[model samples]
Target chain A: MAVSNPFVLSTPSLLYALDLAGTFVFALSGGMAAVKHRLDLFGVLVLSFAAANTGGITRDLLIGAVPPGAVSDWHYLGVSVLAGLLTFRFPSRIREDWSPVLLFDAAGLALFAVTGAGKALAHGLNPVMATLLGMLTGIGGGMARDVLLSRVPAVLRADLYAVAALAGAAVVVGASALQLPAVPSALAGAGLCFGLRVLAMKHGWQLPVAAPADPPPGKD
Target chain B: MAVSNPFVLSTPSLLYALDLAGTFVFALSGGMAAVKHRLDLFGVLVLSFAAANTGGITRDLLIGAVPPGAVSDWHYLGVSVLAGLLTFRFPSRIREDWSPVLLFDAAGLALFAVTGAGKALAHGLNPVMATLLGMLTGIGGGMARDVLLSRVPAVLRADLYAVAALAGAAVVVGASALQLPAVPSALAGAGLCFGLRVLAMKHGWQLPVAAPADPPPGKD
Candidate 1:
């Protein structure tokens, strides 16, 4: 009997890279927002971790992933910590620009949303449920981050963030029907989501605000 | 035929009292915390709704109770809003000492825990999962509340809060098994939970602090 080569590590390595980059950008967004609010260093770090981890945590728990995703992984913690430190060191540079932050935030949302839907599908969730999970993964963390900062969630605001996530999930599900390769299809879906989100921000795309009398609930 | 339903109104009124008081007190706890944190009036109101409604929201959503518990009932919102306004008018006096806040918080936990357990059982969940849902309900709102305030969650700390919620849920389960009256059993559970929490806070009862060592993995 012969052992297989170590080349198989590439798949996990690629996934890990995507996960880390996604976590880092979201954490950076959180840290920068905290700086804008003039929160202390400790507050910035807390916000960063909360924003980077909360969505994945909620998704994992709801989907019955034991111990939850963040608690089960240290890579996420490291990524968030690095981002927090960098944001603190360069607060002025990071906080000055709004468009770039929105772009990076959109990228994080896309990657995480696809990752979430893919994870759920791995666990045998239906397409509808997987889509919901994807939306949650894209928005839950930023919502938690915003509530902690005493602001309305960006997802609830006029943005294409959730729309992009939804579109990505649609791509994955649609691709599955066509018997496309799952791995490459997943990447393409994620890329489409990222591109759409960035383009939306660039073009000032926004969801129509809800009627003021029907203010969205569920913060508590 | 004259429409006369005094018993329908009177008996339901009693059960309504339990939920109403619980909502108001929890709203007060949330509002006072917001004031202490120096949040604006809108902030206090937002926290009040979040803290007062989150446990019920979690319970309803998990049990597939559509429209959510609080959303279906205007009384819950009414009480929370009134409590927020009152706290705003008297922030200094309302949160003068931490005792009342802790007590009200404990009481709120007990109420939601029992409510969640009953709901799960009604929805035909197995006993163990019902207990778990009850626990989630009790702590979920406070977790949301604290996260919004940018603090490490109190439920994750050394206090007996989670324990109290467990006791309340257990009491409900035990009472159901013994065929005790629902109202009386609920009060007993609430009393037990509140007592345990008040005692723990007063005596500074805590889980033993673990000695620091090499931090986990990259934490060092």
Candidate 2:
């Protein structure tokens, strides 16, 4: 079982590095959100970890990979904590502009999407399920962060957020079907996802909302 | 591995029945919430499944149970759908009184807590972790439902909600430590949890909130 565990990634240090970078950036977003919400320092740290690791943890769990890498590896925790501490210490600096956070989030989403699909495929999921899993990985972290803050998940309402992830995941699956190399396929997928997200943000692209006859009541 | 799978529960027909019952009640709560939120039919069904199964799915994932029972078993889906449809069709009848929903929620929480701890123990988790997992299982569903509705999780602020679950889980772990039979131990755990929750609701018991000098900003 140990020999077959794809999460080990002993030879793919680059991919591991990208994963850590994604964790750090997502942690930054989570920490910033916590600060904005006036949560205490401990709460900020918890949000950071939840945002950084939830997607990977969920993917691993679904694929029968016990003790998710985010849990077993100290590096993920270290990166998330570092990002959280930075956000807590310099909230004004980080919160001054939303552009950086948005960019970082897009990058994290792209990385997670491709990586999630590859892992699912490695675990023998069909192409369709692998694609769906990839999108789930991309969106899972933000969804968890939003949920903790008691907000409707942005992915459900944001401009082409989930659609972009699905598109990116589809690219990876398509590449695999064509027998393309993993590195190139991943790069292409990430590029497309990042591009779509940034463009959607810039252009204010949005999915259609259900319009009811009367406005819904304010109370839950 | 098949023989070692603790979730099989070949002889525990009663537990399975109880689990499905818990699922049905929770789904009813979720569907009612969706109707209140003015979500459409699809939204109601989605909330039903999410509210009913999120706890068990999360517990299974953490314990390395791949393809969570909620995903693999048709009965769980069938029960959730039935509850959702019932609520959608008869919102006025089900939502007439809050008391019934609250009681059903407590029952679901109690059932989930003891069963979650029992499963964790069967999977060889330490007593402390198993107890924590039980509490997570009890609260996870409601938290997810509230999050989807863009409201603060009732469990986080509700009267003794998480505390009651933890107490029940602790009782189950204690019984296991004493080598008590599974059936009676589960019954005792559920009884204690249900009692504590109802008492808290009746008496308006609450955990202290952080008293910041300034109120937090309204928007996230």
Candidate 3:
């Protein structure tokens, strides 16, 4: 008996291309972070893979998809390795301006959010859960990279990072509810996410941080 | 037709007890870390759950188990929350002595390693992969906790943390190969792991750190 996997079925060529692009950009960010931290070559590669694939791998796992595409597919590995090598060889060129990396990271984040929600919906997950999963897929890679480097994940405290992903995912979920076409819905979701992230960066927008706490009660 | 899930079939009462013990102890450690970092109540609870269940959840996901026990079953959450509450209420009591926490942590590590390998084998994974999965399960929770707090995972650099788990898992695999009884094999594996961890702590043993790197070549 043949079991049907949604990943094997619904991955159109355009979506696949966008997935690879997202992987490449995320891997580049990981490689840049590794170089900034003065990690060795192997560490750079490891971070690249982790940052590029962790989110998707996590989403796959939650949905009962074993042997996640990042693990089983060679293209993901190849893209991650190529990006890592490029950043390692030309750190100064990439590091000269942080804006480009940030822009690409936003693009990667948007792509992941859209794809993740679509995948979750395909797997029969409810809209609320699918949106959350999509946001998770956007943030999970960067969180893993930061954790491996012993730093707090920027998504946990950054300006509208997760919020942007959630908004994008919600858009996709809403479009599906409205019986819209998948391709145009994805494009619109990605565009909204990318726009929100860039605008937040330009305007120095931020989430509210917790206020300092008063001293704890003595023996109460 | 009823499909047999390995998790539903093979979870003996004793193993279930051990799993809960591991979760509680790990959760305590997480709560202690949160208290030390001055995290709020909700933060403590989140860290506790993340540290207690990440290893098991990851293991189940890899083995094609959806809705991991950590998420599906209520016992794990209840135990984690109980431990977190206790630690939060009596922070000084638990934090005053580090040795107790270390000892419990070792016990939890051993339990997780043994169980992880057994579950992998039950799912028909090869011995080598099962052993490695066991080590990952043993270390994954602590790694998650440390990462959330922005610290390097102790397993990656500490004295024989992963090594002890691997050794324990290897013993389990070896015993199975020799057709030894499952109970004895589990006991032996857990004992070996616990003993090694304690000894390493007592002797202040450490893994070797990478040496400082030389200056990079100019535009090579």
lDDT digits (tens) for residues B1-220 of candidate 1: 1112222123345446766777888898889888889899999998898888887786666555667768998889999999999889988775467767777887887777777666655655555556656776777777778878876566644466777777888886677667666777777877787788788888877643222232322200
What are the runs in model 1 whose C-alpha is more than 4 Å off?
Answer: A1-175, A180-220, B1-15, B177-179, B208-211, B214-220
* Best of the two (1, 2) by DockQ: 2
Q: How well is candidate 2 docked (DockQ)?
A: 0.21
Candidate 1: chain B TM-score against the reference chain B: 0.86
Query: Top TM-score: which candidate number?
Result: 2
User: Clashing residue pairs, candidate 2?
Assistant: none
Each prediction's DockQ against the real complex = 0.04, 0.21, 0.16
Per-residue lDDT of A41-82 in model 1, one digit per residue for the tens? Answer: 555665787788788878876776644555435667778879
Q: Write the per-residue lDDT of candidate 3 for residues B1-220, one digit (tens) a residue.
A: 1322334224467667878998999898887776666665655765787788899899988886675777556688789989988877777765458789888889889998988887777777788998999888889999988879877676886787888899898887777767677777888999999999999998987878767698755632
DockQ of 3: 0.16
* DockQ (0 to 1) for model 1: 0.04
Residue A24 miss distance in model 2 (angstroms): 2.1
Candidate 1 pairs with clashing backbones:
A148-B148, A220-B50
Error of 2 at B178 (Å): 23
